[model samples]
Target: MPVVKEAPLLDGSAGRLVRLYTVSGGRTRPTASLDLLTLVVATGSEPPPRSGPEHAQAMGLCRGPISVAEIAAHLGVPVTVAKIVLSDLVDCGAVAARPPDSFDHPTDRSLLEAVLDGLRRQL
Candidate 1:
């Protein structure tokens, strides 16, 4: 009888590295306009056929509105990778992306002082 040797399994970090690479398909840039604070929500439609697990996972997380950073944290991938996966979903209409609202003017000092005063009063 011939003895067979099984291939060594990847360690946790190595496995995650491979998963990230595979999830992003070795792409480093996202085609969509996505920032850390950009919010994403599922469109209540099924993912396109042959979509990767990352896409499905992203859609699941986006069942409620979620930030790109939050999706990255939940998927255990870098923000860039999360953006790529999200872009794919967006292209297929599985998710919708919304840019965060930006303040047009600098924060008011009075507002800052009021918040500080409120915190002090609470304490």
Candidate 2:
């Protein structure tokens, strides 16, 4: 007969989490870690949101990796508006992009080079 022992537990304001470590082959490994991402949830009233034609169009354009300002110009909206829409999409997980860098419109040579490179890759 063998005795069964329980794992140690960690408690939080939201829930209790169990921490378990396993020993094997002279090595110790943590079997589990706290689900910190999903365990703490947000609860509060949110603002009423709106989307214009350009915003909807931008959402589609942003389905693939894209820069925020590029999508803004493509959809004919001001950069500020585009930024808000992009932020909302990111928070909602509808689109994905690197967070904006201090933006400058891509230069002519830069644009042409990127296009050529893309064409080369496809061929």
Candidate 3:
């Protein structure tokens, strides 16, 4: 069997990807930031034809509710770098980001009581 080899770590690749990304207007909207826990979903089957390779890969990976952290891991780059790439996609509407669900409101008293009841029973 042919020997399998792992892909090299980001190292120079990250810098190169980042440089190209910035040159391609990835930083046009500096205000764009993605939460590490935010869920990303691909809005289209693929990224725009002219998009960079990294953007295309990211768009392809976001077919489901994948977290930003997971995307970074899969891309073999740092989370910060992934955020930059993903932020660009967000700006272009190629991907949709869903904020993490928050339970601060507690609108349903019944649901809250049920959770409390379950916890008490487990104790």
Query: Ranking by TM-score, best first?
Result: 1, 3, 2
Q: Highest lDDT among the candidates is held by which one?
A: 1
Q: Tens digits of per-residue lDDT for model 3 on 22-105?
A: 533645333465778888898874456776666777887998889999988887666776787788788788888887675334
Report how far residue 33 has shifted in candidate 2, in Å.
28
For candidate 3, the per-residue lDDT at 69 reads: 93
Query: Candidate 1, residues 19-63: lDDT per residue as tens digits?
Result: 667878889899889999889999988888788767877888998
Relative to the unseen true structure, what is the C-alpha lDDT of residue 65 in candidate 3, on a scale of 0 to 100?
85
What are the runs in model 1 whose C-alpha is more than 4 Å off? 1-14, 102-123
State each model's C-alpha RMSD to the native: 6.6, 20.4, 7.3
Candidates 2 and 3 compared: the better one by TM-score is 3
Q: Which one wins on TM-score?
A: 1
Put the candidates in lDDT order, highest first: 1, 3, 2
Error of 2 at 119 (Å): 27
> What lDDT tens digits, residue by residue, belong to model 2 across residues 56-120?
56556654556655665675544555555555454555554443333244448888899999999
User: What does the lDDT come to for candidate 3?
Assistant: 0.73
Where in model 2 is the C-alpha error above 4 Å?
1-51, 99-123
Candidate 2 lDDT score at position 116: 97
